[model samples]
Target chain A: MKILVLMKMVPDIVEELEVASDGRSLDQEYLRFIVNERDEYALEQALLLKDGLGATVTVVAPDAPEVDDVLYTARAKGADRLIKVTGLPAGSGARATAAALAVTLPAIEGALPADLVLSGCQAIDDLDGFVAPLLAGALGVPYLGLVSRVSVDAAAGKAQVMKEFAGGVMGRFEVSLPALLGIQGCEKPPRYVPVAKVRAAIGAGGIEAVEASAGTAVAPVEVAALAKPEAAGHAEMLEGSAQDVAEKVADILAARGLL
Target chain B: MAGNVWIVAESWKGSISDATYEALALGRELADGLGVRLEAVLLGHGARAAAASLGRADGVLYVDHPALADGVGEETSRALAALAAARGPGLILVPTTNVSWDLLGLLPARLEAPLVNFCREAVVSGGGVEFTSLLYGGKMAATVGAGAGPVVVAVLPGVRPAEAGKGGAAPAVEEVVADFVVGGGVRWLEYEEPEAGDVDITQQDFLVAVGRGISNEANVEVAEELAAALGGAVCGSRPVIDQGWLPLVRQVGKSGATVKPRFYVAAGISGAPEHTEGMKDAELIVAVNMDPSAPIFSVAHYGIVEDATDVLEALAEAVRKRKG
Candidate 1:
């Protein structure tokens, strides 16, 4: 079985974000980029499928300085191949990215025996959570989102997937092969790869670059402005010793009749 | 030609969800601003009655089908696409729920329309709609404008007052028989609830929730003791549940149970949008986290920037002292 994983690099927002002078985008000069949180989970899910079913894993990601390290790390962590698509404009929305992937994934040599495609359920940067479904629509395959578990029946050419619904309910469904799944999490935490192995994999140099064709399609949505949400600023910060804060909390609870 | 603004009402188990009313409230504002008719589209088995509940809408496009009742994404998207093609609504508002997310993902591609998900606010501007979406998990907000007409938006639930549209005459219902196929590769088997814990957190009057910042499973007892002292239940964010520190029933987040407890204390959660979406509606929120910039602070009524473990220990101790 051949499985493809779509990963992305996003701005690490641990620090405070500064809106650009244009008021429509983030300032890139001081920003640091890292692999998206859930995309790591996606890679892990793909590797799990690889281990269980003896499938070949190919990882694909948009080009960025951080993308190289992510790709190298994927290679060290059992991914068989890495393809970096370059030349796409910055700030490309989820739909455009999905469109490019749908076009580019099929054209790569030796990438085609792909029976399943997995992507992170949502990118912290976009948060639209539409890429996988859009990719499935572009590829004309069934789409499943927020999937937590996946198992394949290679002999029957189908897969059983489990997804979480509202109200803490779980639904299991079967879909034919060559489907796309937006992975939310896996059964286990993603395995860790040490830095030395990733460096050695980088030295081995199996990374391939594909120039993404320009002008696929413009994103329907255009950013009008970007701003920090107005802070509520009403929070009464309880200061002093931990015991004092705790006393204040207990008093509030008592006043509310919760105790 | 200007088109009507349509709010797609989400129905579950033969009733319209609160999210649908929220959409109606938002749609009324946008439609009135654009000088267009605000309509609602309901698609589910026995959805007409639910459609009639949307009195704020000028009209209701009702599609009754069993396949829609369970909300199979593909079928629902196809049905909505068919309705969009026929009616040509300028802006289609859907609630940001699991089903709507799935349907919106496919519908945009099928209709080749732009979709903005998790929007907190929207406005009509220059023959199009501008949407404000929370990004970086609500750290920053971005205002995006879609081009021209026929754009779909997924509005964040609980942002609008559902009561704004409460008092009005029943909307005129128009039955729409759109052409779409229902069954194919995907089939829903059954709904299995998460394992039940000793207390149902959803119905709790007060809750003390923990997150990964609590460090490990052993620290969960600190939260439980505090809850016990306060006569409340203990819940945790997804990671805590995933770590086996708490059962799925005690999990609070998008995939978990949404709660509106009278008092909520969030200890150590970094306030990811998924976790906040479920508990932000509590009457009062108290946040304890080492990071002062944690998004939970944005919605918190009171905050303490301190080590969560230290706060938990002190709170538990204070509760014990109060009981004594």
Candidate 2:
């Protein structure tokens, strides 16, 4: 089985984010990029499929700063192939990214077309969480997203999938092969690759660069302004040690007759 | 140029959701700005009666079909695309919701229109709609404009109050026959609700909510002890739920359960909009996080910059001693 995972690099939220002077994008100077958390889960789900079916897993990512390290880490984690789509415009949203992949994935040299495509249900960057569906629409295939569990009925050319929805409600589905899925998570946490193994993978192989022509977002929406969420009624900060704060909390609850 | 503003009214199990109403509120504002009619496109099997609540819109384009009963991505996308193609609404505003999540990714493509997702706000400006979308999970915001063409936008909740979208004179309803054949490539089989938990967190008067900052499963017990002493319940944000540290039903978030408790103690949560949406309505909020910069502090009535587990335990002891 051939499985492909679409990956995106998002600004790590742990670091503070600043709006650029352009007021349209995040200030790049201080921005730290990492593989989107859910996409990492998507990759983990693919790795699980690889372990079960001995499937060849190919990980693909759009070009972004610090993405090569992430791709290298994926290779270290057991991905068989890495293809970075280059020459795309910066800050392309989910639609443009999906559109580019739909065109570029088929054209990667010497790699078989993926029978199953997986991506994070959504990335923190756009939070559109529509990459899987957009790619499926572009490819004219069926898609399911917010998926948590999967088992392949390779003999029947179908897969049984579990999708968790609002309130943790789940629906089991039988999706035909050659479909796309937006993976919310896997049964287990994503494996951590040590720095040494990632370095070894970097020494062992180089990523294939696939050029993508599609760059512009079809939505002509331009970021007109970017600003920190204006602080609404700011929290009245309680002073002192943990014990002091706790006493204050207890007192307030008592005053409110909540305790 | 197209002349009408439209929102895709999302429903599940025969009831309209607050997300649909929320989108209607935004739709009303956008429609008023453009001087056009606001319409709600309701799709479901036997759902015309549900259209009555969407009185904020000028009209309801009700499409009744068995295929649309479940809001399947393929069927609903095609149906909405066909409707938009026929009527050419200036803009199609969709609430970013579970029911419409699948279609939002496919609808824009089917309609051959641009899409803005994770939208917090939108307005008709300079003869076009400008959208404010939350990116980086509310860490950053982006402004986008849909230029002089039909656009599909997936709006986030809290952009407009749900109450603002509800209650007006009944609107006219127009029945539309969907034009496309329902395709089945991804088919549904069965739905499994969450296993019943020991308690319903939604009904609690006070909720001690832990977030990712609580760190691990071992820490969950600490928060539970605190909840017990405080005479409340232990709930968690999505991270804790996703980590299996807490039961799904005890989750407090947009996708889990919204709790309007009398007092809400948020520990270790960074306050993603999804998490905040559920607990923000709490009458009193106390946020405890090591990072004072956490967004939870913004909504919190009182903020404590401290380790959540430590503070929780300390608070639990304090509450017990005070009661004694």
Candidate 3:
């Protein structure tokens, strides 16, 4: 089975975000970009599948030429080949990107195409968690999101995945390829990519950039502005003794029916 | 400011959660900012009836099918995708609930929209909507924005109260009929509710909330005593919810239930965005912590820079004195 992992280069989410003077975007003066953290897990899972079943793995991402570093890392991590779509319009949102990729995927996958596609549940940056279903929809295949555990039978063309839901409940799902999966917390903790291997991948680079053909365009109603929220308000600490405070807090919780 | 606002009202068993209404309120705010009409798309059985109360949207697109009664992914996605294809909304808002989480990354890919999850606050400023999410386990806040297409965002439950219209005329509602195709290789086998007695915290009237500061499991009893004394409930942070110390429903944050209490006493919590966002709307907040720097203090109406366990015990004694 041919496995493809979709990855994107996103700004690190841990840093503080400052609005630009135009009030329309991030300041970008000191933004650090990196491969999405959860996507690394997706790559790791794809690699593990490849190692176990002797399958070919390919990594694709919609990004600029500068994202070659990501492609090289995928190759070093055991991807058979890497494809990056560069110079597609910048400032395109997820729908446009997915639409663009949907048009490109038929050709990218060809006749003997990927049997499975894996991606992180959500990029820490976009945190929208939309790519997996969009790709599967475009490709006319099945899609699963928020998968915590997965086991595949390449020969049987079936896979069992565990989904983590709120309140510690698990939803088990079975799917057949070609399918797209949006993976979140994993069965095992995400493995670390060795620094040496990353350096090596960075050095041995031969990444091909492919641009996507436009298709099925939809006109958005209006532009939405992005800005930070107003600073939080002053906390009104309820005064009293422990039991008194608890009662006060309890009264509040009870009033709200959330206690 | 580019993109029409989209609201996804989730349904299960032919009913919508209150968080869905709350998200509609947020959608109304976004629509106001964009100067576009709020559009709500309802999917599943009885979705139209459940969504009828969301009066803020300018248009209502309802898709009804029996397949959705069992949480049909294809049905839900197809319905949403079809609506999105017909009337493109720039920002899609969904309540961060179990059903929404199930859609997870899938919806964005289906609609080809960028998504933000666990968002607490969003405002239109520059040219796009910027969102603030919890960081460092809710210790801080991180704001993010997408430079391109339809943005899909999931706001944590209980982060914001559903905005109520104050004697204003209702907006016009437009319904669309579209055929959605559902044929993914997967099917829902069953929908299982968690085992009974798995959690009874939902019944607690007043909760003594704990966060990362309570490193020991035994220390939880300290909170229990305070809850007992106050005749309240014992609740926990998301970590505790994940750890089985508390039920998932009792977990406070975007992923957990949006709780509003007459009073909320947070002990040893740093008030991360996910947790704090849920409780900021509480009627009263009393934060207790050893570190004064904890963000919980910012939202607390009153606070004490002391060990929460010690303070809890002292407060319990004081309550006994005053009440007796």
Reference-based TM-score of each model: 0.94, 0.95, 0.66
Each model's Cα RMSD: 2.2, 2.0, 7.2
* TM-score computed on alpha carbons, candidate 2: 0.95
Please, what are the lDDT tens digits per residue for candidate 2 over residues A54-86? 888888888899898989999999999998889
Candidate numbers, best TM-score first, in rank order: 2, 1, 3
Each candidate's lDDT (Cα)? 0.82, 0.83, 0.67
| Candidate 2 stretches greater than 4 Å from native | A110-112, A127-129, A215-219
Model 3 RMSD in angstroms: 7.2
| Top-DockQ structure, candidate number | 2
Pairs with steric clashes in candidate 1: none
Pairs of residues at least 3 apart in sequence or in different chains that clash in candidate 2: A221-B145, A222-B145, A223-B143
Greater lDDT among 1 and 3 belongs to: 1
Q: Is the docking of candidate 1 incorrect, acceptable, medium or high quality?
A: medium
| Per-residue error (Å), model 1, residue B245 | 3.7
Chain B TM-score of every predicted model: 0.94, 0.95, 0.82
Candidate closest to the true structure, highest TM-score: 2
Could you give candidate 2's per-residue lDDT for residues B31-65 as a string of tens digits?
Answer: 99888899999988888999999999999999989
Better of 2 and 3 by TM-score: 2
